[model samples]
Target: MATDDKTTSHPADPARPGSGDKPGSRAKRAMLGAWFGFFVDLFDIYLPTVALAPAIAYFIAPDLGATGIAITGGMIFTATLIGRPIGAAIFGRFADTVGRKRATIVAMNGAGIATLLMALLPGYHQLGVASVLLFVALRLVGGIFLGGEYTAANPLAMEAAPRHKRGLYSGIINTGFPLAYAAVSLITLLLLLVMPAQGVDSAYAQWGWRIPFVIGAVLAFVLVAYYRRSVDESELFTKQKGTKTPIKTLFSGRNLSAFLQVFALMTGFWLSLQPVAAVLPTLLGADGIGMSSQATTLLLVVAYLLLAAVDVAAAVLSQRIGRRTFLVYAGAVMATVATTVYFLLVRFGPGNPRLAVVCTVLVVIVVVCPWAVLPAYINERFPTSVRASGYGLAYSLAVIVPSFYAFYQAGLGFVMPFNYTGIVLLGVGALTIVGAALAGPETKDIDFRAHADVSA
Candidate 1:
């Protein structure tokens, strides 16, 4: 499964729009548009994680115990995740065959519509169980577009980026995740002050929850407009449009191994990220750690701000050393340091808000830092023709088994405390990342237009 693409390669095509040959206004605008699209992609994805988590009872009975709520909520979250691979396949083909800019616009518009419909959805009281079903369906649909967003945008930004600056560009592009998290946190925090997600009849449970979804919808539409106006298609992609089905080519012969390796690496990332991104906020809230809603969001905002900085630093460092080497060491730290902090997090649950903040910060940083290298590493692994398709599929395909993390937590609950299960998940994820990173070639120096510099 190892990649060994070590040949002299041509530079970016000088004639194409947003070419790295002369990094100027066009590349800058394309990069910004791609980054903004990704920012909003995560904005919608995290709305369910941060914005709707507290108010999920608005769709289900509040009388359901914590475990029951977790099951139902995970089901909702998993629905979205399940749709990602499907979206990756569908939109990956579209982006590879047609164009990144167009695929991205369609995805943004579709995601916006899905999010808008979610805000308009009636609660449990209005339609009984049917309301939850409809919510899950919409989320599934939303996840498809969300999957396509990064599939197209990341490659667009990377292709537009000068090879030397790819590492920095990758890190800058990824800041969208934590920044979006912070944005969602800030918005949700303000709403909690007025909405108050306490009971089925509470203001937040009724309407305040809808505000974030509405805002998320607006963000998606705004990105659509931005992309249509400012973004440019990948010159590399335009130069070599895949005549063969990109998806089929990925699973054929040697490309299959590359796909599997990417799948493995991304699976680890998704596993490690799930707890920090989705569950941690809830754990810090009144139920698990006894903090007020406002305090929890505040702590998350601080942690995410810190994470954004670390992400950039780590990505830049990866360029200096190598992506493979960085990931191996980072995965090691995640196994020991990150998991140990998680142990501290769960052990010291309830009271001690300051210590809780520290634990959460450490865990968040340790678990997510390796992610800084992935956009560049994965993009470097595949050639221009299949870059988006391979990226989309490899990225989203891995989330399948790991998306059942809540169920795994439930099963693990028999032998240990429910909260302690996160430690195990983190440890396992670390192993996968380390093992997969070891299999890949160093990719920082690969030219975007050089097929000989990448594995099939």
Candidate 2:
């Protein structure tokens, strides 16, 4: 409700109380709230990665050892992926129909509760097959909400941002993912350092893994409070709501073309980025890539920090050069370089954790830049009349397709040591580059009230 109040004023327009022309203190606050929500969402989603081994050892296999551990970890990721589409669709619709502010609050609270339940879950030893089934169910629930967090938050930030600085503002929102990853990486490193290898299995299986989830839950509550205190519903949405046109009307004609373009961009972006950035650390660490758990965790933390920094840089650059141009160039570069980076990693092995760290960081920098531009790009694609709904539908479609990526990549041998993740990366990167060139439109200096036809 408070968010709705905030959304009604156009901060940049002099005629409006919070017009776009005014200083963007309110928009900044909204961005902070959105960023915080995304931070907790990501941290909770990735918690299981650091704790996978311990969980598998305790619950999946006391005897089969590494094989059992791998299988269990795979299953969890697979289950989480399957649940993502459901979250994306359900929450996306809510954001479009009800409002972004309400949708985000619901998602954050739901995901937090789900994470807490995961922390409280019984181990397989204590509960047998039921434990695994229950864990999957909890994660599924969490994933559903998690899917909607980005869809709502990204558009909200974009809708609230000044048009001139949309690229940088959108980049700031995208940075939350890497920043949260860095935090999780640091937390995992601390856990690994504090708990000896033998103790890790028992401690994490029994309880340690739950700590991050609980922390995530607490942070979620804080974000919800922040959103309630600060964020406003988008003025764009308010003006549109006064119109008689149904939100669904946006899906017809030229708007439908715009939706398809956004969806295609997202598919290519996620397919390339998620595998390298999101899933790689877990796969590498669990596969025993020649680094100690502590070493691997440290490497991942450093890589994530680098990624965050690069994301900021990319966002700034996009504002300067233009989102479409920047994305096209970055995607092209990533596609070109990914193969070389992957080869270097395989040739050297994780024997030197530093090599893996540097290579991974490079991959992230290349991959994330294009994605960092998406919030602004998607926001600019629709007029105020159907901005949230248009963005939600298109973005969710992109996410839903890429949700099963980990399973698909594993099946393709990208998860294998010295295998073809690099090649996959290159291929996906090239497709993204081509897609960006073909579909992306320049939004710099465009007025949202004027440029209603984005596909043109």
Candidate 3:
């Protein structure tokens, strides 16, 4: 069950090297390709966050109330999260029927084209109401394809990884997300340094945001080529590709428990993480932390780097111990350490850069690092026949709930005293996940090639 005992003998693995070849190198390449595909998908997803401020100023009419801008901003984010499920339904089916490689190629290209189109869209000044419509449409398109990328790439990577080291590979793949987030932040920080911040009217603020989208579009296309040329289809997938409906297959009685387990796990995972990931840096300044803009940016960069490192370490440790044990302990940490850190950061962040950094690091370690092994864990839950569809559906739906974390926090902020809303929500989310994890079976030693019955 441990790393040394599991077979590395997937002779039929499409990416497997021939006699006298370095098998490890080929597998590593495949993993890196999957990781990069995820990286680009996340980069495109986070673009809206970086663009939101400039977008609000440029795209909204001044006469409209704050509610109008808030609604618009919320819609922009909601549109993408909604579109992902739709994409998951479609591409998940496509991946099982056609091939993971083909589905990935199509999805990546679709996302890249949609992203490039965003760069060409007119702002409110040029297109008026049409601009908002176009923006939403483009975001929907990007979200759909990005969702497809997740469904396809994750299983491909998990199946490609050496069975014993799936956790390690999952950790590497998870790093793609935070790395892209950090990259976007770095890009935005640099742009803001030079761009004027003259509220709502600064030309650079309005147009400069487009530059990153353009770069993302280009990166997407490059990934399309790279994935097509470099990545291989999962041998497990190839062996089990079926002619039946994957979605329906997932809901059959035999697979229902696995589906529900993943759904709960994904829900708790995303709901707990998004608030901290999206709000922590903003909270630093809002809490009256005396950190300068330069200091804030540096802190965020360091935090993300630390997050990446923790992800790897946590993933490896999960393999050594057990997935269930690690998850249970991780849930405990999120419930206890992360919540306490958030409270301390909010209460004591004023004039304390060192304290702020320390608190942020603690939150990252507990709340974020444990998620690194999720791809592998989810993949382990189902057989190859419905793995992509099940993972995609569960992940997409789970993400939809968390997408509204902003609204949840806003509501909590209104009712809660002393701005402890975030800490409380984080605890609730972590406990929800912990409850779900307690119901799940330990899957660390599950054989990738073995499958459960598809029918009741």
Candidate 4:
């Protein structure tokens, strides 16, 4: 077998890094575990965004105007975003002190259970505003569980990865984003065809939304069980002593600077992503450009399908170049090409659905390809002791600023047409990512064990 850093395992001594003593069984399992967590994370989280968009009226008051309804629906997302950082802080320290394996398992179970319960909730007609409150609260809890999960899972995978294959592994794991999203669109589309989506008495509004929640719950459990049975603790993490207070340690000295750089990049990523990923479907449909529900979902299914291939391709390319260099280039595209695509989409999309599809695909490609390099890039930014804590917070906490994308859109309305707001938001997000990438180091080959106070 090749070196463990390649596809081989290490020498029996856990303290040692590499010797190529065994086959890459451990590395393969670690990659599978990591991929499972990320896939399940996006699958469960986006079910509401894509699947529940039409059925949102079931849980909220029907009398709210267009803006009120938009804000109320966005509130569910807002609550989830609020919970993620808290989960990151809580679970990051737990993973640092306890073990990545244990933290991941517990988080998956919590999220899965929360999703299953969402399917059983009473609608607004049954319990009035309390039903909406309960629904939002459950989503918040689900977000926390999922937030904690990737904190442990991602670091474990990166630590176990061989140096040469880190980029490939990051690509494979991040593919979950597109594939899961595509699956949600497909599932919701099929359901919409079978169930009516219009009016107060439609089957979809009453309970069709619940079906996706149930499916998401089941996927989460199956993936978690597979992860538990197949994967072990990271060979490196097992050897090191645990940090007593990783969160506090993460905030001290240079770790803080590293965290800030990651936060800035991630914040931009979230801001740029939210408009296209979450809101575009709604805008393209009955709200903005005047497409049918089926047509809108079909477009998303196609875009996400294309993205799956593009994400892997981008990852491979980033591997050939460097993570920092590729991100800088991708950010530049987001600022320029992406904005141009959005303008094209808005201007031409109303009469030309095919052009709309092409524009959406291009926008998604430029804005999201940076993610293909990020797992390796972000994981390499810190040492083992605070890896989970730092990654979790940096990845999740920055979402708060971008979580208010709606308000930013609303604010943009004062200066320009509401329909054109996404273009400005994308530009702002693009600049932030480019600036952050320029400020950070090239982490393509940083040693995981360096630059930390390792415990005895």
Candidate 5:
């Protein structure tokens, strides 16, 4: 499971004979394509939040009130979480069996079609309870595609990246989320300004909310075309083919330990990160903590911008410091300080936008840094043959359960009650730190090809 200390040398030109450059060159481009697809996927997934108010108004009866709509929307989000694991199972196996290129294509295209259909569907008044059912069904389908996208894309990027630069490359790929968030935020702002709002009734019933979904569908299609023309099968997969490493066998041989390790790591990561990352803004916004919608949007955009930069930097830093040490130290610091940071926000958040901004900045600095290095670290743990499936299954299982909890908490109007949520996050963070300290292997300067069984 350990990569050899000796480095493989090649000619200057990767395209020339005896040069190991072609695969490296191809991997770089493929990584870009994979991340581009990921960017679009993130955009589509988050766009719904911007339209949540309108969606509820259109679907729920006036007598039912906002609480009812909140509950319904929460259900949809939970349903979407359920679909993620299904997507991971189906697409993860396909990526291992068929190929990463084909699997990615299917995921991107399927998500696009699902979103487009959602854009066209009628509202509650027009379709009744059937409308809500249709929305949930479509979200489920979209979730499946989304589930497959990350599993295939992350492994593809990692396998393609140069060994020395894998951490940085992985970080760059993950930066797509923040970039997509910024883009979606900008788009939502533009739509809010331009769209004629004749109150919640007309906005939701007519066309306001559909605009973003339509735009996202178009973006998805565009990404599909881009990936189709630019991306190719990973060299690592080709090199490791015919090794008798089917999906089932992955859990049996040397890969078994690696799989468990990744599963445990991801579980802790998701449990600590998802709720804080995804739920905090909505929680703060709805709580009337003096952060108006415009101010909150501005703060999110700024935080994401910082997150994108820090994430990439952390990835590059891992090359010098080593992945294990970086994750362990960083995870511990974030976990230990997160509760204190939340307390700071709750204390100073009532009338002070400046203090709120500071708290926001602190949260991003802690949460996003460790997340940046994970894709590369996980990728280095498995062989190219079963990498996609392994990473997908592990990451999805970790994400789905925690994400469900996040939606449930939001639905129940839970927040920093006696610092309960913060305590939970801190515990998970401590677990991540402990896991890394105990089990994480140093991947610095290791040859990815030689370490095919590192997770073993």
Candidate 6:
């Protein structure tokens, strides 16, 4: 359907450029398919951030209070992140054993179903705590599927892309995550615009948030079809079809450091990136800023767009300077800018909306670049045999703590302004990432075509 040949392997290998049976077109299809699938997957992931507070408050309102709502929201996200590593371990194995295309289709379908179920879930008023439990359960399911997505899709894309252009392509494709967030922010903002301004919270909880989940669910299914029709198995993976025990291979002494380095990178990257991307909306709604939901959504939409642009630029530049150098510098810059902007937002954000928006745009630009180059960088670290599982497991495990950043910020809010809490978290995370990247090797010039039996 997409001029992709399922029966034969393509020329572009995930690890290195090679002369294969076909032209570079297969790689193009993989990149496009991976990009779209991730767009839908990440859109579903961040949509909850926009809806979580209002939706949970609707359930546990008077009895649970703000503290209760905050705890519940944090638990839901935590469950989602926790489930991801489990999914990655399982699905990454599948990606290695069966094929990337099979894993991708299964993961997408599971995520779509989980999201659709969330849309149909009864409120806390009707089912009481049972509603909350079911919601958490479904989110966990979604997390598993979403976790599997990165393992298969990112490797497929990277392996398909030309070695010389990996940095640029990696950045462009990974932009899906931020762009999806921007899309959700825009949709939420539009819904707020059309609805009556009065009783906004009540209206949003009642039905407004569900609109986005419904859209995400539909989008996921569409991507499933698109991928099924267009995506072919990775050429590099195809050559390694008979490799024994992918998970086992990953833990071999020679490959151990590669795993560890990626783990550190993923941990540092998510720790730094999640607070700004996921927690900023809640932070804005807190007492210090007290911005309305509509205003926050508008701010995030603009900020996410800026983040996407900055990520692309950073990704392309990584090609010239090398991934390690780019990440180290980016993380350091984000730390300085985020720490400074936290104060800026606190001093002027409440009284000056335009200034807050401008500062937010700048903050996102710095904080988001580290994530842009990770897919290609991580992909380059391992051979095709264990690439999916190694990358997925590291990526999923690294996010475990950051997933709870919202809850941590909420508690810290009592002792300090939430903005300061975010800044501290961002600063720490940026430094951690920079330190890890500094220790890790540059992946830009690595020969992916060679066996990844030894750590660089």
lDDT (C-alpha) at residue 65 in model 4: 82
Question: Per-residue lDDT tens digits of candidate 6, residues 1-456?
Answer: 112223434444434423232444666677777788779878887777765444556556456766777688777877787778988998899998888888988998999999999988878778888888888999999989988887888888887676667777788888898889888777877776665324325677777778899999998898789787876777778875624588888887756788888788777777777667666766677465778877777777777777787777888899889988998888888778777886798778887877778777777777876688888898888877888888889888888777667677789889996667877788888888888888788888665555455366
Q: Per-prediction TM-score, please?
A: 0.90, 0.85, 0.92, 0.91, 0.90, 0.88
Which ranges in model 5 have alpha carbons more than 4 Å from their true place? 1-7, 12-24, 196-200, 203-205, 242-245, 286-288, 404-420
Model 6 clash pairs are 14-159, 15-448, 15-449
RMSD for each of the candidates: 3.5, 4.8, 3.0, 3.6, 3.2, 5.0
Q: Summarize candidate 5's per-residue lDDT along 238-321 as a digit string, tens digits.
A: 666623444686687778887887777777777777546665676467574667777788888888899899988988898779
lDDT of 2 by residue, 1-456 (tens): 122322444434533312453444656766777678778777876787765445455555356566666676677877777666677667666776677788888988898888888878777678877887788788888877877777677777776666656777777777788888888777766775676436424565566666777888889888888888778876555554422342456668877777777778777776776657655565466463566556666676777677777776788788889877877777778677765676676667557766777776676667665667777878787765566566766665565566666566667774564355545745674576567556757765456645356665
lDDT of 1 by residue, 290-369 (tens): 88767877887888889899988999999889888999999899999998888888888666777898898899888887
Question: RMSD, model 6, all Cα superposed?
Answer: 5.0
Candidate 3 local Cα displacement, residue 285, angstroms: 2.3
RMSD to native, candidate 2: 4.8
Better of 4 and 5 by lDDT: 4
Question: Residue 418, candidate 1: how far off, in angstroms?
Answer: 3.9
Q: Clashes in each model (backbone N, CA, C under 3 Å)?
A: 0, 17, 0, 2, 4, 3
Instruction: Residues 82-189, candidate 3: write the lDDT tens digits.
Output: 889988888888887787778888998999899989878777877887887888889998999988988887877776676667789889988987898789878877
lDDT of each: 0.82, 0.68, 0.78, 0.82, 0.73, 0.77
Among all windows of ten consecutive residues in candidate 1, which has the lowest summed lDDT? 1-10
- Backbone clash pairs for candidate 3 read none
Clashes of 4: 2
Error of 4 at 95 (Å): 0.7
